[model samples]
Target chain A: MTDNGPCPLQRDAPGQVLSLWWASTGQETAMTTSGRTGDEQAARAERLPQRPVRPLHLQAGALALVLLGGTLGTAAREGLTLVVPEVGGFPIALSCINLVGALLLGVLLESLARRGPDTGPRRSLRLLLGTGLMGGFTSYSALSLATQQLLADGTVGRALAFALLSVVLGVLFAFAGVLLASRRRAGGAR
Target chain B: MSVAVFILLSLAGGVGAVARFVLDGLVRSRVSSAMPWGTILINISGSLLLGLVTGMLGAQLLTPELQLVLGAGFLGGYTTSSTASVETVRLLQQRRMVLALGNLLGTLVVGSAAATLGLVLGAAL
Candidate 1:
């Protein structure tokens, strides 16, 4: 995410990704105005130098939005866990939740970037949905605990496989989401 | 779970998310690495705490409902898998294979280690 003012950290590396959940929002402004090709814009947005640095500041409104979105996201995750029976204690529900969250976050961020600069409503939605909702919905700690439990239960193979597969699949799913959104943008432009 | 407990769990999740936001901001403000140190720290810490909570639950130090509120709600909200995954993909897209792999594998390995340590500590307690 981008910040409100120029952040020295934002200017650290040329293509460094900006903002985690708690950081400032709105750094991907270059892609929309560069007049570059769509693919280039997308690539640059993901890789090249970002827009001006913005200092990370605490915003009550953004925090509140994140809080609200997080409540909904946590409720949804809890509800799903209640219904999705564990498959032989493999935590299929958690894997599903994390994978789905990764994909949706990819889609949301890409679509929002393509739509416009990360400011105003775009920033708000990113904070609410991307940082708050998706961040709350997916869990790495639970995955770690589950893996540890499996190892403790003497299921070494299952433990390793579960962890490896989930991480690998999560990256793939996120990439798939980016492609899905990019394709849609292209189709719409044509 | 009772409706009150459920609502409390959800609110706890909200608070946890806010906590994550604040901590990440604090770390990001100080660190200027290409890697997302903020998220990496948050995940490791949250995993450790979750492991401790799980051990405590096993030892009957905490009730099941309280466990749910803290484990599934608080830690789950605080430690984010999506951000980690998306950040990895973004790094890979940029062809920073070393950093990408480091971010991916480092989190998994360190986070698991932290969880193990927490479990041990909790059980000892």
Candidate 2:
């Protein structure tokens, strides 16, 4: 149900569309149409999700640690090896990571679309684990490296333009995934 | 020790990431309107840092993995365009069209320039 009061996030300016992000009795926290109510406008702050059973939490932490260490360590070693001036200025290690991240993000999203949320908790877990952690690990480092390599190889226009576009559009695609996921979740809640 | 290196890099990455987070918070708090000074500042500064590191590494000056751990790993994570894009979407959803457009345009225009500048200056140094 849409509230008629002004949104808490908005200013006193009239007709200002103040969209309040609130988590209520119902899950998927409805984005209330902007308005305000007395004594009830502190913006819904959801408590952090409870960590799983102790064993699960430990497992998650362990997994996270391993993933973080492994990815970073490999990148560092790769970077060290690629520091030659003859190569691109930026380390090639990051290029490898970046490419991995981009490809994984694409694949994960595609897979999620197919799986299609068997449950809310399951869906959320997938997002938090698969998207946040995994997406973070994989990066456009490879593409960046390729761009640098191309530039070094005297393909200036292609390298610079491609690099610029990749950074620009890579960001847009990530945001798009977030948007698409949220919309899908919201639509399912209906 | 390899362990020492790991601890050091992780600590640096953590501090840099947190700093980026705090700056974003400050930006959001100060400018309720269209300006995303937080991200703009972070990205630009990060680019410069990358440039500085790149220049050194390119010159075979920086020690191995020093640039990777600090520059690529730390700074790359520190600077984010995804957050900016999401904030832009939030502005648009809240019907802040002008703000959204301004944020998008400003970040791209300013960010690229900053990165380019960083490369040039770092190379010079």
Candidate 3:
């Protein structure tokens, strides 16, 4: 038996050692192939050997955490809407809420990835905060509806601007968050 | 909002989030694509539903409070901008500029169209 291959002990081992090994080797293979093709990452990821399916109980636990986190996040968003005050009929509150959520999600995901692979506490936090809280806090439906309303109201220019700005700025903000986290890690390392 | 309505809204939001999570997972498992198709589908569908609700509100078929709960609370949680934005950024980081731009623009364009269709259909009803 090759000692380098995944073993039972390694599979059950605690902490980031197993994940690091998988990331360095397994993910490198996927990344390299996908990097070459650019569009085949997901297909390659699926074709690659996968980890064992998680137990049902663990999956349920994740769902429960998402539910709890989503509730709190939605409430927070609602509370903010009550006080955020719109500007001249523009959906400023909605835009700010979405931008902030996107920024925070970028920060949270990058920091967690830096900390370690997605497992144990890290996985829990990702589902709860990243998927659940931030997901709930931001509203794409509202953005779409607001744009539609603007167009219907004959302000086609404003409608187009709103839609474009929201999508473009949102992506930019997320990138900024990723840079912020990575820089923090670099500073800490130094 | 009243305390009761607030609680209901929050609960609805939780349900919507769970629905999004489940639907996304189901789609992801079935389809392997570099683009975040799951989020795109979710956002478009949620936008459609919200638009329908809005039309209903305009037609006086749904109460304002009910619209608040369903539109702002449920559909709001169901459709996520943050994930969509982050996924686009990730694509850009991977140097898939075309896919990144596609994901960003595609979602907005298709989602807006879906919302408009829903609104028209709902108003016609």
List the lowest-lDDT window of 10 residues for candidate 3 chain A.
A26-35
Q: Per-residue CA lDDT of candidate 2, range A31-110, in tens?
A: 23346553343434323244232322123332333334334433443344445333335444444444344444544453
Clashes of each: 10, 16, 0
Candidate 3 C-alpha lDDT tens digits along B16-109: 8888888888888889999999999999999999999998888888998999999888998889999999999999989999999899998899
Looking at model 3, the pairs that clash are: none
Q: What TM-score goes with each of the models?
A: 0.82, 0.51, 0.82
Docking category of candidate 3: medium
Q: For residue B5, what is the lDDT in candidate 2?
A: 59
Better of 1 and 2 by DockQ: 1
Error of 2 at A10 (Å): 34
**Best lDDT goes to which candidate?**
1
Candidate 1 lDDT over A58-174, as tens digits, reads 676678778988888888888888889999979999999999999999999997888777765567678889889999899999999988888889999999999889898999999
Name the candidate, 1 or 2, with the larger lDDT value: 1
Q: Name model 2 segments beyond 4 Å from true.
A: A1-156, B1-7, B91-109
lDDT of 3 at A184: 78
Q: How good is the docking of model 3, as DockQ?
A: 0.61
Q: Give lDDT per model, in order.
A: 0.83, 0.48, 0.82
True contacts kept of each: 0.74, 0.02, 0.75
